[model samples]
Target chain A: MEASGEVRRFAHQQWPYEPNYKRVNGWQMHYVDEGVGNPVVLLHGNPAWGFLYRKFVKPLSAAGRRVIVPDMVGFGLSEKPVREQAHTLDGHIANLTGLLRQLDLRNATMVCHDWGGPTGLGFALSNSDRVRALVIMSTWAWPLPPAEFHKRIFPWRMMHAPLVGPYLLGHHNALAGRGMYLSVVDRKKFRAEAQSVYEGILPDPGSRLLTWTWPRWIPLDESARGLARFEWLERELRKSKFPTLLVWGREDEVFDHATFATRFKELLPHAEGPELVTGRHFLQEDSGEEIAGKINRFLDRIDGKQS
Target chain B: MTEIHVIENYTPEGKRRAFVLAEDRVGHYPEFREFFVRQFSLGANRLERPGYVRASSGMIYALVFIGRSGEPFPDGIEIYALPDALEPLNDSDVDADLWALLRWMIAGVGGEWRVEQLDATGRLYQLSVAANA
Candidate 1:
């Protein structure tokens, strides 16, 4: 057999909240909606899914903030057709924006993490006012990776390969559950059910192709047309006057918070800022309640949704 | 006479079930996903709205209830224990209210007053109370 198909993992931990999985763009998108008032949209990035917000979702919603989280195509509960079409960063953003449009969510507070950078901004760039505030996490929005760090995250030597390439993704666990679990060291904090929910997302190896190939679309070169629109998006992010909240995990690996911290401050100078000391690229999972508190105070302080 | 609200893990047929009270009409919350993910020490709730809990160990079991209505749920409050701090519920541990516990959780949140953890088992715990932190 070319690959194994035994990925029946369960989020053994029960969510204090229930998850509502809906169909859209030919896939099932699992999201949680709580309370009413203003809507806060959280977009996750590569190898990661909406589950990243598992920690923050509850507290935010409990505080009367409507939280919307979607696992982009090929990730989480979204159907990953192993035999079908390819997953593109641009395509993922479009599908997510479509989800928002279909739901008719207005004045949303957009929060992005990792690959979420472009996904969150792509929509905000076009509908600036609808975006109440921008929360940029450990990721980037510019075209292509800086020549210095491209190989660090998206080494073509592996992604462009024909066969073993996909295996590398699953083998790393970062490409799958092991990788995600390996990143978090605290064992007691996570219940069997919580780990089950996160790992349950990936069903097989073929479906794991999205994780293998998504990094390839980082707009590494001119041949990638996506780079153009991304360049424009980055410029818009830098100039947009919307109130922004930038939270960086000081301990992030791929996205050294130190580097992006300065970048965001320069781009959105007046934005409210908070730093997570022991945080990782997945800050919400590492410190969800704390971040939700920061968001709560931020919203109340600046009225994040007031137009 | 006070209301005797009961939560049973097993029905008469021995099938396990979740008991959500009348005020619990909201059923399951869709937005509590992350708090479960992050495992924040203490989850925040409405000014006076508290949640419910049931803890059991071996032969000893304790039904815990806490509310944030204008009055405490049934007239009791609760508290936060250290992580994985599971223990048998003793008759001595059962009290009219959960003041010490709820206060501990609020103190963790930088607040001196918030939440009431009533270690109560009775009908009074069912009646809604006046507003509280």
Candidate 2:
């Protein structure tokens, strides 16, 4: 999915980071590789792309750290597979794994948000030696059932429905349209221009399949498609003894930090925060500078500890 | 068989509290509750404190507890349903979506279970595992 002229112009104005790409699984996976030093890989989640981290790349890199933010296949400027099954958890994990191996990003700090939590942590768990530290935002790494109230929410249930999900997500781009705005606490931050950049990447119904499949892929039970892999990742993450930092937006209506922060603390007991309280689900949008500052300090502190 | 006993309490201020008592006929309440909390996006800290675990959507808050069957534990899992949380369900379509989500949660447990919604208004929403299956 190539960025349209409008998206390119928007990127030029708002996000000026150098655009880089690598062919992963026969698809052009777009990423941002900036600065120079110990690598910091940023991962994004559903309804978003690498552009989600546009604000952080420059600051983190300027602070003497390389920042690598990749748009998963089916997102941003990456090639979108026509088939829904092609966007499986394994496929995403593989694409990222290949990209990291190709770049030889060793002892890197992984900063992840939303679905990035799972995919990034999934990578960390498997490649623990390569992962020096972790910065987790609003996301989960376990396979659990949806709460009753979660079902009541229109988007969660509607996106999973057989007929309705395809129509709303694929046909209308409902998530990119109204869903993104609803997820944020500060609505003004997600202005018309931002929406245009996101919508431009997913221009048509055919390009929206990845967005449609993500919500439906939430593993509600052991029987759900990716439950086994999620279970494995969860077990590995729980046992992983890496230096970790957790930053959260208290106001996130979806993936509320109050709900999941404690679990993350329990999993990585030595992990540093449930830091940054002002933002929403997309904390990058609300508190990107604060998050980046914290990341820099976290890196320095962990490096000091090792020395 | 895993039995999930749900107890609903209403305060004088019209606030609602929900509690869950998981009794495993096969003696796996702890395991079941652990898995249950993880799946429902319930915070593990609440297991040690009197805090509420908000769902992923930040709409539902559940105060969860785990114990052996017939151990004289709290009668049920207490859920605090804020007005804003339940407000969206005012629409009939969203209400149906809620039921579908509940049904999906029930199926995830994968056992013969029964959910008895004991509300004073006689709005009994019983979720029989077999029926949901």
Candidate 3:
């Protein structure tokens, strides 16, 4: 499925916000192709698109890294196809698969967050050869923790909930407010300017649902498909043994730091580094410059291996 | 009618109190009694010091802190929205949205407000809300 009218408007107006890139599949796929070297694929999560990596684009590129940030369908400058199926994890993986095949991205250093965790993991799982290293932040790839409401109302149940879910997500849940951005941030980093930029991208109600619907669609508990997908990726990570770096926000309000560590450690224990960052869920937004610096150093360590 | 119910008192330092508050029958932030006492001059006494922080009162109420980094600012306290005490604010019409729920969860509980499966894998969500500024 393609992006909906709401996300379409978002793609048209909100995008090209930075520089480089153009329309693909009637959706605005923003990308920065500069410097030139192997490639680095950065996938963002819900309530965000390719724009999330606006800062990393230039630096990584200047350092001779072909950084590719695609606003996955239903987010940022990418097309927001509202159909629940359109935004599923597997579907996204497929979309990314096609994009990678088309772009011929290889030896990539993936920087993933929130929903991007699974999406990026999915890519690595399938295209194991393409990945050189990974940087995961404030996100999870584990199956849903055992919780009832978390079981029922995850990204799936809540998205398709009777009257209540849609209303809460599509309208009442103003994407511009704290519901979308504030929730992920640590209290110490909350600021008006950052909030303004977030609110600025999403001016109308339609464009906002793209933010609200993301969490609702995650099949947290009984999502066999998502679980299977995640499991398959985990198996690959274990089998492939690709280097991975995890940076978690200790004070995160969404996914707890300890919980994130316990799960990721079990999955990628062999990976070089995984630390609980004293940041928030929106690590890129809250600590963008810091995160970029970390990524720069992390990738250099791996890229330097060949040199 | 304004309602104030004690939800917890188990700290060992100053008094630690949690209250279930109602505004026009609507549930808002769950405030700590001691902070209210200090900030509003309520003069409420703690059962003892560190009464609420160190001990578990065996109840589920939202925890609140006034300042960032879990600092308990005067009048900034915890409000325990007892399970039974949680009543639908609206019967005929509802203004509650995801945003409202997010705000209430943040203000009411210092952590995320997640409704998990009543009986399942224990899946949970850390209901993220706005800062208390």
Candidate 4:
């Protein structure tokens, strides 16, 4: 926790974005704001901060879209609360809501992945008027059964285990350390420098709780926390006519194409694709350039229709 | 004369669960006192009252303190420790000496044991195995 500033400095070295801060809730929330035009807001999931979308910022901004990526409260340069209770599905949505309202973002294109799926969709489903399009990747907004890999690995049980969970996750930084490494298809791309940036950002046991909470938050049934909101998301998704697109990490075992991406298509029936590209769970790391191209083209199509 | 008392209970599933009180304080035993002080600096002013929590799988592991026990801590399992200020809990410092202490304490109870903050003013010190040992 003491070395957090040094870690943030190191993170900025690789992340290479001018940091912006907004006082959302009590914590100083960190975000990246670049270019000018209709806003394209990007949200990252657990164990990932705005750094995940660093590759997209330049291209998307050059394409004349404002890029805004917020490091969800618990991750990135955002001020982290030591208590796990501070991180909840509803709490995150509220924080995102606070940021958007303060920034006065409207007619935005929302890009979501991993836990970003729920956090971004949660905001979008409720604030339909403010959003224009959505690009969903390797994430879920429904309360489906645990995915196959999740079932096989049983991350839920381990993450919640008393000493074991805290030791491996909160204490040992296993999720951000080894888990992030395994999240990609090409292990070569996940170099030690990048890994340190992820691990360095969370320097202590308490700082790692956010990563630990995301897996534990996976909804198992209707009684799960944030179930009602996700239910609302599932029920409301079809009704929304916003231009939608689906993309996936071809090799993702965690939220693989068959289960997650396919389900996304089923819900957003008219959505553009279940476009499978290179990478695994953290697909953005593996195929950011290729995916950015896909996103640019998708936005162009959306712009054509609007014009 | 460690003056440690072992409290036993059954989980809802009827698994045998146990915890220890070291003279109604943490570090009543010399070994625990030495390890916590060396690793966590149990004398630090910013932190207070370190304890552990029990999980569903019947494992006791996380380090908790007064006014800060958060999620993944299941209900009903009581923790007993001498309220003592320790060094900021870090992942790297948790493995060797702390793990050795945890393994030693759990060995007495047959699998799992928890230490908790019972009151704001009371200090729960080093726990000793009164029953098994």
* TM-score on alpha carbons, each prediction: 0.61, 0.68, 0.61, 0.73
Q: Interface RMSD for every prediction, one decimal?
A: 25.2, 15.1, 13.2, 15.5
Candidate 3 lDDT over A139-191, as tens digits, reads 77756541233443334343323222334444433443444454555543444
lDDT of each: 0.54, 0.65, 0.53, 0.65
Candidate 4 chain A has its poorest 10 consecutive residues by lDDT at A1-10
User: What's the DockQ of model 4?
Assistant: 0.05
Instruction: Please compute and give the TM-score of the first chain of candidate 1 against the native first chain.
Output: 0.85
Candidate 2 local lDDT, residue A183: 68
- Candidate 4 at residue B63, lDDT? 36
- Give one digit per residue, the lDDT tens place, for model 3 in B13-113: 32223343211101112232332344333344322222121112223334343332332333233333332333432311222222233333223333322
- Candidate 2: the clashing residue pairs are A144-B39, A145-B39, B18-B77, B18-B78, B18-B79, B19-B76, B19-B77, B19-B78, B20-B76, B20-B77
Top-down DockQ ranking? 4, 3, 2, 1
lDDT of 1 at B20: 14
For model 1, the stretches where C-alpha displacement exceeds 4 angstroms are: A1-12, A21-23, A146-149, A153-161, A170-174, A185-196, A304-307, B1-133
Clashes of 3: 43
Of the true interface contacts, the fraction found in model 2 is 0.00
Q: What TM-score quantifies how close candidate 1 is to the native fold? A: 0.61
